[model samples]
Target: MSGTLRFLLASWKVNLASALEYRLSFFLLAGMMFVNNTIWLFFWYLFFARFPVVSGWEIGDVMLLWAVSAGGFGWASVLFGNFPRIATIVSSGQLDVYLSQPKPVLLNMLTSRMSVTGAGDFAFGLIVFLWAGDLTPRGCLLFACALLLAGVLFIGVMAIAGSLAFWIGNAEGIASQVFGGFISLTIYPTGIFRGAAKVILFTVVPAGFIGYMPIGLMREFDPGFAAAAFCAAAIFSACGALLFRVGLARYASGNAMTMRN
Candidate 1:
């Protein structure tokens, strides 16, 4: 465990050094993200200003959803930026080096890229979250737990999508669509979705639990719902990890005979 932590820290340091080499570009990327999310918030504010309530959710409730989802995504992008690109690595036969290493490949991938720009998105999400506050101590605790679980889910989904590259050769387009679909779902109130749509969102896609469900529990002070969301997150993460391992066993190096870059 200690060795793994050390490797991760070292990797982060290397990534930071590389990013600093292009400081202007890094800050510009961060600035762009800030502007994008701020614009999204503005649109929502305008939306609520006109409608006052969508279904039963207010502007603050919607903001909470955005806060958790955007914050969760920012963390994922910062910590696991390489996840979505794993497909490219596999397709390009770049995963061979990772497979030859003594360390865990997944761990290596997780720590390989540290997106400094995601820090801006995280900061923006947190600011919006605080500004929309109705959080109790318990709500705060639950939110933290939910955020962690959401990150796990995000990584899990990315892994599953990336693993498909092994069979499909190039799955980047599919992965992009999948990610976009998930993000689109989280932008609205879950209450607006029902029946089969709700079931699919809550289970297969899980955009519901990413933000809506947890925020609902916080707003309503429902421990049972919170517990359910936590359990779902755990199960989803475990399933995702298991799926990745299955995919790894089936992975064939594009070049089996030589150690080539």
Candidate 2:
């Protein structure tokens, strides 16, 4: 366990260093993403200014929603930066390098890169949290939990979508759509989605687990929902891992040259 943790840490360190090599590019990418998220928040601000509330959600709740969604995504990308690119890697036969390594293929591949834009998203989340979240210890703890669960959900779901490449040959487009759709669903208020949409969010796509955290886990502390969220993340992760492992049997070599420093 300690050795695995050390490997993860070393991978993250190297990824960060690589990203930092081009300092200006890193800052610009991260800053641009931060500004983009802020713009969306501003649109929500304008929305709330006009309506004051949407399906029981106020500006503060919306802020926390963004915080969890973006922050969760940010951390996941910064750490397991390859989650979104799993399909591309698999389709391109990049997994050969990872498969040859002593480390776990999925973990090694996932941590091989760092997204500079994600750093900005993470910063935005903390800032939004300070602006709108509960400052108390309990509130802070719950918020952290929300972020962790959100990250896990993103990684797991994306992994499953990406792993489709193994079966279908190239699933990059499908994976991209899933990524966009999941993120889109996560930012909106869960209360606004009803009937079939809500059901799909909670069950099919499971975005409700992330979207509802601001109210369910942070505000009211619903144990049932919290447990459900944790279980959902666990199940998705397990499924993704299982699928990837099974699919590896069918992975074709792209025969492209690849290397790692």
Candidate 3:
């Protein structure tokens, strides 16, 4: 376990140094993404200015929602950068090289790349939290915890979606759609959804668990719901791991030339 952790750290160190090579491009990409998130939040701010609240939810709740959504996604993309691209990798046989390596194939594949824009997303979250989120001790702790849950959940769902490539031949488009849809669902207040829609949020996409984090675990501590969310993350993580194992068993090698760099 210690050895695996050391390898992971070394991998990230290398990735960071590589990203720093082209400092200009790195800063530009991350800056643009931060601005992009701000623009979306600005629109929400305008809506709340006019209406004050949506279904009993004020702008503050939405702020935490974005913090969790963008923050969680940020860490996942930065650390497990390839989570969303698994379908493309699998379908294109990019996994062949990783399969040939000594390390865990999934872990190796995930850590091979790093997303520059993820730094922007992560910074934006902290900035927003400082600006609008609850500034309490408990608030900070729960927010951090929520980020962990949300990040793992994001990776888990995308991994499951991407694993479909093994069966569907070229499931890249499908995986992308599912990932995009899941991100879209996460920004809104879950209370805006109800009945069958809510069920779909929890089951089909599982965005509700991420969406509800601000209210259930942060704004108001709901022990039962928090425990359930933790359990959901565990289940999703196991399911993704199981699906990827199944897919890897069926993974075929390609004749394409490969290089470590």
Among these predictions, the greatest lDDT belongs to 2
- Pitting candidate 2 against candidate 3, the one with the higher lDDT is 2
lDDT (tens digit, per residue) of candidate 1 on 161-253: 777877787778888787788788877788789799989988888888775744556677667766767777778666756666676776766
Q: Clashing residue pairs in candidate 2, if any?
A: none
Q: Assess the local accuracy of residue 241 in candidate 3 as a C-alpha lDDT between 0 and 100.
A: 82
Structure candidate 1, residue pairs in collision:
none
For model 2, the stretches where C-alpha displacement exceeds 4 angstroms are: 259-261
Question: TM-score, each model?
Answer: 0.89, 0.98, 0.97
The CA root-mean-square deviation of candidate 3, after full C-alpha superposition on the true structure, stands at 1.1
lDDT-better candidate, 1 vs 2: 2
Q: Decide which is better by TM-score, 2 or 3.
A: 2
